[model samples]
Target: MIVVNLDVMMAKRKISLTELADRVGLTPANLSIFKTGKARAVRFSTLERICRELDCQPSDLLEYRPDEVPQNV
Candidate 1:
């Protein structure tokens, strides 16, 4: 499964949701959805802006975790 590591990245950058939203020119509501990992899709331009603001790469914000089948679980 794909996972967003927004929380970790934000923590590492010590940025607040409001500040990040302001920096990215995104509404707080939109940022909140992303921060909470509820977003199903993200725009490339948005991602680039975020990476630029956060000093991170897209790889830093996203991760791929192999699903453990029910049997493994």
Candidate 2:
């Protein structure tokens, strides 16, 4: 499973959702969706904009955690 650490980074940066959204040229609603991990997909351009605004790396925002459920049944 992939988890988004956007809130964490936002906290670290002490930036508000509205502020980040404006900086990244995204709407607050859209950014909120991504922040809450409800987004099914994200474009690389969007990711790049976010990283540029947050001054963070992609790895810092995304984390891969293996699901505990067994794949082979």
Please give the distance, in angstroms, between residue 35's alpha carbon in candidate 2 and its true position after superposition: 0.4
**lDDT digits (tens) for residues 1-73 of candidate 1:** 5677987998999998899999999998999887766777899999999999999999999887796322221
lDDT of 1 at 66: 90
The CA lDDT of each predicted structure is 0.86, 0.91
Instruction: After the best TM-score superposition of candidate 1, give how far the Cα of residue 38 lies from its true spot, in angstroms.
Output: 1.1
**Model 2 TM-score?**
0.90
CA lDDT, candidate 2, residue 73: 26
Error of 2 at 14 (Å): 0.6
Candidate 2 lDDT by residue in tens digits, 24-47: 999999999888877888999999
